[model samples]
Target chain A: MPVNHSRQKRGIAISPKNNSPVSLFFEGAKDTFPLIVGAIPFGIIFGTLAATAGLSFGATMGMSLFVFAGASQFVCVSLVTAGVAWPMIVLTTFVVNLRHMLYGATMVFFYKNLNPLWKMVLAFGLTDETFAVAVSRYSKNDGVPGKHYYNLGSMVFMYGNWNLCTFIGLTAGKAFPGISQWGLDFAMPATFIGIVIPYLVSKPMWASVITAGTVSILAGGLPHKLGLMMAALAGVAAGVICEKVFSEKKERI
Target chain B: MFETGIQLYEIYMVAGMALVTFGIRYIMFPLSGRLRFPELFERGLRYVPPVVLTAIIVPSVLMPTGETLNLKLNNPYLIGAITACAVGGLFKNLLLTIVVSMAVFLGAQWAFAMGW
Candidate 1:
């Protein structure tokens, strides 16, 4: 598969086109730094909770490495501590992560031009943070060269930071047992606000946000974060319906 | 207060969760290549970012533990989040939003702890 090298030589110096792979990678890292800061406490809290839940260091780290979804990992640890059956734990986590399907599908538009190998790698690294950064970048200019390198950069930094914090929490969790209670989790919601608020320039977009936010709270009592899945589905359905209705209204007028 | 052991069943659980999580993340990319989406479906995918993100953010802020359901003035997360959203809208800076939100969160927590 020939890379989209033709998109290069447009000679736009402001875009990723003029940058080297190494420079693009670092640029991605730099762009993602603020989000990573928000993730720091969440990662450490996972470590602390895992340790407090009596999970062995290897098991805790293994969960972080293998599952790699923050909310699901937290749910898995809680369920494991609660003595829930392993199958139930697995099933619940699976349901919680179903949102990744949307992330993957949405990302596929920009990624369609890349080879399968690049797709596979980016797929692994497609967490919410990376998706937010990369999607915004692609939305701005889909033709930027080495954009995949930028994605790789964000992924590597987040991956390392998560694992490192888990280690820190596993070891230092005992020393600072109250760390998780320090209200740091707010950073994540705040980051999402920054990411999503800027993009609500249309009715369908605003409808999606209103629908998803309302449904998420109403469904919060659902087990294993099923509320998240329900809210996401509802929001997408609302957005599509709103888009259709609005377009039809415009056409008729 | 908690039992400490690496039981065989726990290992199985870890592997099972990992496989399923990875499967969900991995399955979509290939399927998108193989299958064709309808025109509306493609358009709907554009809203995925806002919708999914709002879903994640709302519950975390409003009901931090999925149980608290805090909406009062003393709920530092909610107050700080409102402030953060305003700052984010006004400034359009992630670092500033986080910094302001965290500062508001910590400050609110301290203020409430002091009974005012």
Candidate 2:
């Protein structure tokens, strides 16, 4: 398992304890708390911006309640504000959210044996922060059963926090009219930096980050935010190629 | 004087976004049991998080305005992101990283605005 392999390489001991479903669930929520902090500004900003974008309070809250993805919601609201057609707005949302497909694929290994209902519920909650927290927990070979409960916990916590923040933003936006311009949106990127920096433990990872970062900046002008998808692909390709090349060199030596 | 709170097109748009977003997220779940990916492809998937996150972060920090690059020292976002990267590298604590970075970001913004 990648968890065991990485832990061994890092000289960290894997805990041998097994956790009950209840504990795992709460642990999931607790571990995801910091990420929720990062997401607060993001959720609130979305609400505030959506309100300003001419989305009714109902529509703004509806997006949070149903769509539940921060980045895509932002894109959708921005497109609406631009006076784009509804179909085009939806298409952009689809494109913006395609990264979640990769997340879903990564998570499939853990949920393959789960019941359909459990799988569906968990999949709906698979945002970037939840995935970050849950994957690290799942990756640990701590022999924990019902790890999906941990995911459920994080999901519920995040869902609640997001909606609450959106509500705050909606109310605050009307009051302050300048809350969105306070640079609060920096929280998301700061949180992302925290997530990514720790994963840069290998050359392939570094290659992936550098390539993706550069490509995203260079292609940032692409229509409908397609640059994000392009940058992601380029980054993954770079990582895979570097991994192969480096492993081949080790074999040759 | 007849006004429903939300317009019909807005409802349609939100519904469409919800459907597609859920479709992307849930598509793999139903197929989970029946699907087995190649090992090479699986390896590539591990890179997805870092890559996707970096793609998002790079643009947000470098182009906070969403229209132009802001690499100058006065750009609080750039300063804050760099602070975050360094702090996270050294400490590896998520909350600490966020708190410290946000403080730095705000401080930078204040200083620049004050002509300091």
Q: Which numbered prediction scores highest in lDDT against the true structure? A: 2
Whole-model lDDT values for every prediction:
0.84, 0.89
Which tens-of-lDDT digit does each residue in A1-253 have in candidate 1? 1344544433454463346788889988999999898999989999998888777777888888877788888888888779889899889988888988888888878887888898877887788999889888778864557788888999889889999999888888789878878877787888888888888888988988899999999998887678888888889889899988999999999
DockQ score for model 1: 0.68
- Candidate 2 colliding pairs: none
Q: Give the per-residue lDDT of model 2 (tens digit) for B1-116.
A: 11229889988988999899889989987766677788998999989998999999999999998999999987899999999999999999999999999999989888988999
- In candidate 1, which residue pairs clash? none
Regions more than 4 Å wrong, model 1: A1-17, B1-6
Which candidate wins on TM-score?
2
Instruction: Please write out the lDDT profile of model 2 over residues A87-130, one tens digit for every residue.
Output: 99888899999999999999988887788899889888989999
Docking class of 2: medium
